[model samples]
Target: MTAVSLVDVASHLPPERVGREYFERYSRPDDPLLRNPMFRAPEYRRYAAREDTGADLVERAAAVLFERHGSDLAGEIDLLVTHNALPDVPFLGSGAEIARRLGCRPAQIVDLHNGHCAVFPYMLGLARSLMRDTGARTALLCTAQTAGRIFTQPGVRRSAHAAVPGDGAAVGLLRASGESPILATEVRHYPDHAPDVALKLDDGRLYWEPGTSEFDVAFDNSKAYNIIERGSEIVPEVVTRVCERIGATPKDIDLLVTNQPNRLLLRNWGAALGIEAPRHFDTFDSYGNLFGAGVPVNLDHALRAGRPAGGGLVVMAGFAGAGELAAAAAVRLPGPDRPATPTTGGPR
Candidate 1:
């Protein structure tokens, strides 16, 4: 039995909006995926920073969440989980940094490393296990990414991958409670597809390699194509399996919140899952991909907009960059003993 209920959620998005026009200003007409309508995003939010690290983004996001949900859970947080694809600091853990920043001294801190897309579902299951083992009462599950500095730099500006990533962070407060329970969580790794996405620092310059091949080969544009081909199939499979684990179907889910691959991919995924257009929430179009922060940030967006009605069953699913990893979970919002409250963006 899972012993977790998400009580509140919040995120911090860099105020700057980098639109497609900005990309067009630097893109060549024949630059394949960069300008293609099928893969292009109109704009994405990027946090502007001078010396701040990924830790800063995580702290700012948590602060936003605390501003709204902190008073009640501040002292109750006994566990802290942080996830980030690119840590601003080397060797040191973001989880500990976040815990220290929030002054959660007694809380146990751990970091989830399943890329940016899939950690939410993985974290849910992990949090449940941790609480049961440690007897912790509350867990702060947080994710943030500030890859704009790396992915949008001059070296990447000439590649097809430059247009896909953005920056932001999200924090979710999950408590061990009988209220607003988590029905089930499922995770699977397809390491066979792990080669689809990668980042290499070669020749004194960094390059994001995102694609696959039939045989072992070096980097190129096909890597991106490989991800598109493979991701389209596995993401939906994991979502469905997780739903079945909870004795539910895609039709039974009120809202399907997954990673921000792109608006087109998300729409296609929704269609593949037999979900209606309105039932799925996406921030990829508006914020690009915030990597690990994608799931929680999108969930917060839906909650703020009053989605997944009272007692609604919300399905959260995500796939990481490696293509081998995926996770999904089903949660029912608005506890039976309490009514829906907009303040927490969660069940009351």
Candidate 2:
């Protein structure tokens, strides 16, 4: 097994910040179930990428990571894993595009289509496996979203549960090492609820389909309710499984960061896991649901804010909108005994 080192993480968001009142005035739905109670957010920053595309977001984040690390990362990064929460274009893969933009000619590029929840943890595991088996030195994991583009058109802005989405991109550099051990990683899929949450095209307009769980509705519960309930269940379960596999307990983790659905979900998850409020890093109120970008972006924010201790254990978790997919990873930060290496080409 290869020990993974988290070199560093970088993120980028567009300039325009939109408030909840803007969504309520222009995009709120008529269905009572889809009201602000369910949307449950105050504001989200939109990437002002009117003239740009999803690839631009990915490239910009990659550029930030490279600039922070300097020229050393150019040849050392051997793999590029790129993905986005929503499908922005057909035929072209964003991961490959980012790799091309960075001129990482020797790096193997893999594109993931798992959307928001499963991608980050899944990529972490894959990068570890690739480094272990293929002798790759480093891997760059990136998640980008151009979610604000959905509102560019006129019709169906008030579609069901069409809570305003923010746009952004995040990147992390990982290398094989024991300096910051990634204890365990897991991802699970629940196909039964796959269709409960999705994007649908209707009458030449894009609309979101939320809370349509047929089986759960029999219990007099909304599909959105069931999705949240299932998320509340699975995140903790995966955290427990990872802890047990690594011979660690929930109490042993020093920090927790999960995908941002809303402030309420983060609070509920912290309560269920018995983690203190400060241990969990939250960006929901400010950034909205960044989809796949949430985990890395929040992790970057937490690390920069000095939330996690040196040599401390950090647990990262994420779940899909319909609660159909889930993933978690446990990592121990480098401490004085094992100083973090320069986040460039070489392993610590």
Candidate 3:
């Protein structure tokens, strides 16, 4: 059985100036904030709502991944997998739109619509299954989140929603290879608390009520709060299982990528595991939260930008709405056959 390694990764962020200035200009000194010191400054897009559509972001990023690898988009890929919660339109999944833009045929596309945690694991599992069953050679995996639409709702607390989320997309090429096969993957689901962190359809629009309230009556459940508390435990447990299956300790991990919710959650989880802080490749503070795209986006950023490169174990963990957690580990393959090159593509 051949192992799977991310052959190439690419990401796109909406223009980074508009939102940054808006926050700086309006944010108060006393507002509750979770600062991510790893970033010298926040990364964000200005007027992302008006500037770019969600499908546009995904297509642009995928174009870069193909160009960087010097692979022919039409010939190289046997399958395409997309993960997103808030897709561009109600009826059409983002995967189909991406495939259409890339000129890929209907037979080549599959859509996985789950929250943040569901995307990567679903893609990984699909790749593994395809390799075992159909002997497919290459697959394109993409994840994107356009939280701008969610946070821009009238009356929703923009400070809380906008502070953490940023719009972005990540794309990766996964191929069947003998060298770096995916070792182990584990996913934990906590359904009893499903209502805690949920996106609901109110009237005709989508609404996100992060936390529950006790006070009066309607829609006052603290689901978001419960998700955080339970997530603390879920993340550690999932990581432990992945480490044990792979016969590696948390200390042995060279890089750990967790869902970019906030700086505080990352720190708390790092402390809980007694692992020194791994190089945090975060886009959340600047981009806000990219929902399902979090892990792939971070991995793409770390790989493309310069980082200490040698063979070491890397962990990718995802935690999304409703206390769902997915964890997987891969040994960073020795640097590519040739030094990596910058991707040439249009603005995403």
Query: Which candidate order results from sorting by lDDT in descending order?
Result: 1, 2, 3
Runs of candidate 2 exceeding 4 Å displacement? 27-29, 34-36, 151-153, 204-221, 343-348
lDDT of 3 by residue, 159-266 (tens): 443444567787877667644446677776666665554444434342334444211101222543555567677777777778888888777666777776656567
Scored by lDDT, model 2 comes in at: 0.73
What tens-digit string does per-residue lDDT give for candidate 2 at 261-321? Answer: 7666777789989998888887877888787888888888887787676648888888876
The TM-score that candidate 1 achieves is 0.88
Q: What TM-score number comes out for model 2?
A: 0.88
TM-score of 3: 0.80
What overall lDDT goes with each candidate model? 0.74, 0.73, 0.61
lDDT, candidate 1, 114-182, per-residue tens: 656888878988888888888887888888787665655554555555667788888888877755677
Residue 11, model 3, lDDT? 80
- Please give the RMSD to the true structure for each candidate, in Å: 4.6, 4.8, 5.8
Better of 1 and 3 by lDDT: 1
Minimum summed lDDT over a 10-residue window in model 3 is located at: 212-221
Off by over 4 Å in 3: 16-47, 106-108, 157-159, 199-221, 335-348
